[model samples]
Each structure stands twice: as C-alpha cells, then as structure tokens.
Target: MKTFNYHSAKDVKEASKLASSSSAFLAGGMTTIPSMKLGLATYKNIIDIKGIKKLSGIKVSGKAVTIGATTKHAEVANSKEIKKAIPSLAALAEGIGDPQVRNRGTIGGSIANNDPAADYPSACIALNAVIHTNSRKIDAEKFFKGMFETVLKSGEIIEAIEFQVPQKSNYQKFPNPASRYAIVGVYVAKHKNGINVAVTGAKSCVYNDKDLAKTLSSNFSAASINNVRVSSSGMNSDIHASAEYRANMVKVFAKKAVEAC
Candidate 1:
C-alpha cells in the first residue's frame, strides 16, 4: 500500500471534517485496503471511523431494526436481537465472505461500497431500509445510484441503517464458491404495504424486481412467480455465468426466498 496519513477519528463530526477529496473513511477496510494494495485505488488520507463508539451497535424497535454503520458482519450474524427481529438479515450476514471477512467487514462499508454482487444491498432493498448519514437520511431505493455507486457525498458519513420490520422475509443466494459473493441473490419481504423482491448480483446494481414483487404481492407464494420471466437485458455476463443464466437464477432464488419466507 502507498503511504497515507491515517487519522483515528473519535466522533462523526471529526470524521466528516477530516475528509477531503482524496480521503476515505475507514471502517472494515475489507475493500479499501485490498484496493489500495492492488493499485485499484489510493487515498491521501484514511480517516478511521471504527474508533467512534457511536458508530457500532444494533437497535431493535417494534417497527424497525437499526444497525450502526460500523457494526461488523459477525456481530450482526451473532446478535440475538437481529436473529429474533430479522433472522433473514442475520442469515445474510453469516453468508458474507468467510469468518475473517465477516469479523472484519461492516454493514456501512458494504453498503457504501455498493458492490453489485454484495448480499447486504439486497436486504436493504427488500427490507425498505433508510440509510442514516451525517447529513440526511436516504431511502434504500434512492440511495443506490449505479454500479459501485451511492449518493453519499465526499465528506458525508453513514451513521446507521434502519430497516422496516416485515411480516415475513427471507434471503436466498447462489454464491460463487470461491469468493462467496452472490452470483445471484434474492431477498423476499412481505410487509403490510406490499411484497418486495430485491435482486442482486445479476445486474450492474441491486434493484427491486417489480414484476416479481407485483406477482408475489398478489399471491405471496413461490408458485406465484413460477412463470414470470426475468429478462437478460442489462444483466452481467462473465466467466462464472452467462447473462441468461444469471437472469434465470434471479427467478430461481426469488422463488427460494419466498418459499423460505
């Protein structure tokens, strides 16, 4: 890694104020450190946010489950509150990468990085999450811009993520064996308002499958979307799987998620 000034920020204000155009807030450093070592990215300053006590915890209310930004994947995976309130979320956390990554990676880093194949983004979408930042709160639907992109400003820092509690929800993913990153993942959530079918790992970004959601909202069953065809257009195609195959897996995983729910 290249030389950079590292600052261990004590609070949100300090972290945000320290950020510059070439600065990055360090949480888990799962992606940031790797990218730097690989020469894919470089930062002039690394503002460590992990030291901020306010940025790590889990809060479960009757209406929502709010997770602090720096909460580790392993913490979420093992949290009794998370398991009792949103088991699907805990399951998703358990499925992220390996034990080391799970212990080191964080919810904020995962969502902020916005990796297309990431598991957390699908849960955020399906659970109707609101990203709480230093500046403002953003809806999960509106937060994500595109591939590896979010609406987070240069100096802004995510504080927490609040997910609306659903009546029933489940997540299913076809993971790439080597990396455990989803090749196709689906999260099905049935709320009082309606059903949400969030799909990831098949496109340039995670998105809600309107057709699947509409069909499932009407019936709320695995068989309800059996005949619904997911189009291959705008899907990712690579060595692991073809665009058509990934598109097909989207439906498959959606059905699995609904059945699990």
Candidate 2:
C-alpha cells in the first residue's frame, strides 16, 4: 500500500475541508483500506470522519427512520428503534458479510462504495430514502449511478440517510457462500400509495422496476409478479451465476420478498 498523510477531522466541515482531488475519506475503512492494500487506490490524504460524534446514531420521527452516516452496521442491526420501525433494514444489516465486518462496516461507507452486490442500496432505493449530504439531500433514485459509483461529488460527505417507513416491507437475498455478497437481492416495500421494488447484484447498480411496482401495488401478492418476465439483458454475468440465472432469481426472490412481507 502507498503511504499517505492522515488527518483526523473533528467535524464534518473540517473533513470536507481536508478532502481534495487526491484525498479519500475514511469512514469504517472497510472498502477503502482493502483497496489501498491491493494497490487499487491510493490517496495523499486520509480524512478520518469516524470520530465525528454527530454522524453516528439512529433517529426516528413520524414514519421516517434516519440513520447517521457513520453508524456501524452492528449498531443498525441491533437498534431497537430500527428494528421496530423497519425490521427488514435491521435484518439486511444483520445479514451483511459477518460478525467482524458488521462490527466494522458503516452504512455511509457501504453506500458510498456502491458495491453492486451490497445490501444497503437495495434498502435505500426500496424505501425511497433520502441521502443527506453535507450540502444537499439526494433522493435514493438519483443517488446510485453504477457499479462502485454514485452521484456524490468529490469531497462531499454523506451525513445521514432518512427512510420513509413503509406499511410493510421485506428483503430476500441469494448470497454467494464465500463472500456472503448477494448474487441477487430484492427489497419489497408496500406503501399507502403503491409498492416499490429495488433489486441488487443482478445489475451494475441497484434499480427499481416501475412495472413490477405497478403490478404488485395493485395486487399485493406473489402471483402478481409471475407474469412479469425478468429479462437477462444488462444483468451481471459472473462465475457465481449467469445473467439468465440472475434474471430468474430476481423473479423468484421478488416472490419470496412479497411472501415474507
């Protein structure tokens, strides 16, 4: 790994100021540290924001659950408030990687890294969550760009994520045994107005399907998605699973999610 200067930011403003074109913000360092060690990423400045107290915790108001960016996956998984308000999210958190990774990984880091197989983006998009940055609030639909990417600008810090609680929701993931990353994961959320379905792993980015949403919103049943054919095009084809296999799993998991909900 390349040697780099380190700066500990006392607050979000300081962290933002410390970041530069060649700098990287250190949250849990789950993804960042590994990349650095692999020589895939090197930064002249490492702005550690984990010490910022304001960026850690879970808050709930009305029907919304807002989670601070630096909040650990373990914290979210065990949070009673999160469990009561959005149990599916807590379940998703608990299912990430393993005990050590869960204890060390942060929600902000996960979403920021935007791993195509990561679980949080599925929840974020399905819940219609709002990503609060240091400067602006980005809707989940607009936040994710593609694999390992997002709309986050250079130096911009994700502060927290606020999820609009649904009437009922559930998550189902077909995980890869070794990595515990999803080969295909689906999050289904039913709201007063309609339903939202967010899929991950099968695609380059977490995505929502309006057709599936419309069909399920009206029927609210597993059978509703039976006729909704899942296409293999644009899916991620890997050693773990083929695009066609993933496409089939998308439908299968969607049914499972709906049943669970």
Candidate 3:
C-alpha cells in the first residue's frame, strides 16, 4: 500500500473539510483498507471520522430508527432495541460477513461503498430509508447509482440513516461462500402504505420491483410471487452464477423473505 497522510478529524465538519477527490473519509475502514492494501484504491490523504461521537449510536422513535453513520454492524446485530423493533434487520446485520467483519463494518461505510453485492442497499430501498449526509438527505432510490457508486459528492460524508419502521420486514440472501457477499439478496417490507421489495447482488445496483411490492402488499404470501418472473436482462452473469440463475434466486429469496416475514 502506498503511504498516505492521515488526518483525525475532530468532527463531521472537519472531516468534510479534510476530504477531497484525492482523499477518503475513513469510518470503519472495512472496504477502504482492503482496497488500499490491494492497490485497487489509492489516496493522498485519509480523513478519519471514527473519532466523531456524533456518528455512533442508534435512536428509535415511534416508527423510525436513526442509526449513526459510524455505528458498527455488531452493535446493530446485538442491540436489544434493534432486535425488538426490527428483528429482521438485526438478523441481516448478524448474517453479514462474520464476527470480525461485523465488529468492524459500519453501515455508513457499507452504503457509501455501494458495492453491488453489499446487503445494506436492499434494506435501505425496501425500508424507504433516508440517507443523511453532511449536506442533505437523499432517499434510497436516489442514493445508489451503480456498482460501487452513489450520489454523494466529493467531501460529503454520510452522517446517519433514518429508516421508517414497517409492520413487517425480512431480508434473505444467497451468499458467495468465499466472501460472504450476497450473490442475490432480497428485502421485503410491509408498510402502512404498501409493500416494498428491493433486490441486491442480482444486478448492477439495488432495484425495487413495483409488481412484487403491489402483489405482496395485498396477499403477503410466499405463493403470491409464484407466478412472478424476474427478468434476466439486467442480472449479473459471472462464474459463480449465471444471469438466469440470479433471476431465479431473486424469486426464491423473495419467497423466503416473505415466509420469514
């Protein structure tokens, strides 16, 4: 890895100021550190935001949950509040990578990376979560652009995320054994207005299916999607899985998610 200057920002404002096109904001450093080590990513400077206390905690109100950007996955998985309020989300966190990765991975870091195979994006979409950044709040639909991409501007750091609680929600993923990254993941949420379904790892970015959502909103059954077909047009076709396979997994996981819900 190339040597780089590191700055320990005292707060979000300081971290934002320290960040630039050539600099990266370090939260848990789960993805960034590995990318740096592999020489896949390089930076002239590293702005450490892990020290900012404002970016580490969970807050739950009547129908909303706000999670600080730097809050670790382990915290989410073990939090009694999360387990009670949104057990499926806790389960999702628990299933991410393993103990060590969960201990070190932060939600903000994961969302910011926007990896195609990452799990959080599906939850974000299904829950209609709002991504809070240093500048403004962005809806999940607008946050993710493509693989490893987001709408965040240079120097803008994610502050926290706000999720609107649902009546029922569940997440299911078919993980690649080696990396534990989702080969196909599905998140289903039944809210007051309607149901929402988000898929990840099957495509270039997390995608919401209105048809599935509408069908499930009414029936709320695994059999509801039995006749539904996930198109293979936009799915990823790699050695691990084919586009047709991912298309099928989307239906399979969605059914499992509905069953879990």
lDDT of 1 at 164: 95
The 0-to-1 C-alpha lDDT of every candidate, in the order given, reads 0.95, 0.94, 0.93
> So what's the TM-score on candidate 2?
0.98
Cα lDDT tens digits, model 2, 139-177, are 999999999999999879999999999999999999999
lDDT by residue (94-164, candidate 3, tens digit) is: 98998899999999999999999999999899999999998999999999999899999998999999988
Candidate 1 lDDT, tens digit per residue, 123-242? 999999999999999999999999999999989999999999999999999999999999999999999998899999999999999999999977888898888989999999999999
Q: How accurate is candidate 3 locally (lDDT)?
A: 0.93
In candidate 3, which residue pairs clash? none
What residue runs in model 1 are displaced by over 4 Å at the alpha carbon?
Answer: none
Q: In model 1, where is the ten-residue run with the lowest total lDDT?
A: 217-226
Q: Candidate 1 at residue 167, lDDT?
A: 96
Give the range of the ten consecutive residues with the poorest summed lDDT in model 2: 209-218
Q: Identify the candidate with maximal TM-score.
A: 1
Tell me how far the alpha carbon of residue 206 in candidate 2 is from the true structure, in angstroms, after superposition: 0.5
Q: Which residue ranges in model 3 land beyond 4 Å of their true spot?
A: none
